[model samples]
Target: MTVTTDTARLPLLLTTLLLPTVARLWPAIGATADAEGWPAAKTLATLLEHEVAERASRRIQRHLIEARLPSGKTLDTFDFAAVPMVSRARIAALAEGDSWLAKGTNILCFGPPGVGKTHLSSALGHALIDAGYRVLFTRTTDLVQHLQTARQELKLASAIEKLDKYHLLVLDDLSYVQKSQAETSVLFELISARYERRSLFITANQPFGAWDSVFPDPAMTVAAIDRLVHHAIILEMNTDSYRRKSAQARAVTSDPGTTAHPN
Candidate 1:
């Protein structure tokens, strides 16, 4: 339908002039308004909302790509039943809206190897990315080495400043870092710099006492723990290895070379 009258053409003209960037939407907006008999106000509102959502989706995709998050993990795919002690409700809230990271609250996940710590952390991070939060994932040793290199070049502060851009920094397998002053010093500096400004989501195979093996010096170890636990959420993953359990189930379900078990 043609807008022959000046009264009807005024709103459409204004919409195009105001949203020149989304001029492609003008045709659909006019078509929708004509077909649905919608008021200009309603049509403009709907098209504007659609434009905002599309832009948000594009931004989220970019964040995910840059995040380098562990793939193929989400709350839906996690076997919460296997780990009964974990608080599913709490995790869901944090992933969706807790915004604990916004207040510089750290998250510490402690458990033996294969207990799904990485999986849980990665899944939560994926959720946060979808929720418009920036996340960066790195292994404990790699990030420490990177920091140490930055220190060598006298660019440690600059490196840390770059990292501060992310809302949450996920360090996987903190127990693997060797007890070396060079490594620990840089790591400590990172923690100290972001102490009350950014968040850390860390996974460790060892408990707090065992962390001394990673830090060596008792004072530095204590300081690291203090900063981490202050205003933090501690998740103790005490369950057995999910990978082991899955392997055991597969063995039981598999055939044993045509041999039948006696009933």
Candidate 2:
């Protein structure tokens, strides 16, 4: 009788339209009300609010995994004071979706390996992701190979088109792409296709002047540099290698008890 009464109280259209999770909330709501002396309606509201938050958290987790971002690197964990030259204000502004993103500005991180370039790039991608943007992270070699295979399979255009869905693409370790015309062409095509339409976050181990050995043709190298730098924010990670420091610290901390005197 109570069930029938409750069913009758809900409009037919509304009952049909109700989400499964919302419908499932009734039992939990009733338990909460009985245990805590909350009004059933208030309990329902609280539970539903929690359900929305949990679902959003799960969605964020899934997006992060799908993004293929390198692990353990976020703005919170980054040692920003260690690299004071990277303008925190500028990066924070960029992460907040300022005019640069909408206007297709790129981010180029130029530094030697092990200097936290990848860490900063991945951390920035996470910030953009938190702001509800779609981002993809891939190594330059892996992405180039994938695109080359797409070209061989005669689906290069469609492949490039599919990549357009992502708001930003983080191409890590750009210096590792072998110095061959085919690889360079594939990579150039990708850069050209996204020009002024989407943003790129590129990490390289060399400065722009040193990129000629990587690109097969001088003209292509010049063109690529021009396009990438037109509206770019260059973050020069000119710091000592954190990896080397960490290793040295560990070695010092674990020194053997016997120190040899001049023998």
TM-score of each: 0.86, 0.83
Give the clashing pairs for model 2: none
lDDT of 2 by residue, 1-263 (tens): 35445554444533586544555665666676888899767876876786677667776788798889988898888878767888888778888875777878899998877888888888888998888777899999888889889999999999998888778899999987866736567778888888998899999998888888767788999998899999888999888887888897788779956465896
lDDT of 2: 0.82
Which candidate achieves the best lDDT against the true structure? 1
Residues 1-263, candidate 1: write the lDDT tens digits.
Answer: 87566655655675666654355576777787999899989887887887788778888999999889888977878889988888899898888634577789999999999889999988988999998899999998999999888888999999999998899999999999987645577787788888978999999998999988777488999999999999799999898999999997788679556556699
lDDT of 2 at 141: 86
Q: Summing lDDT over every window of 10 consecutive residues in candidate 2, give the lowest-scoring window.
A: 6-15
Q: After superposition, how far is residue 100 of candidate 2 from its true place, in Å?
A: 2.5
- Which regions in candidate 2 have their CA more than 4 angstroms from the true location? 1-20, 30-52, 256-263
How does each model score on lDDT? 0.85, 0.82
Evaluated at residue 215, the lDDT of candidate 2 is 74
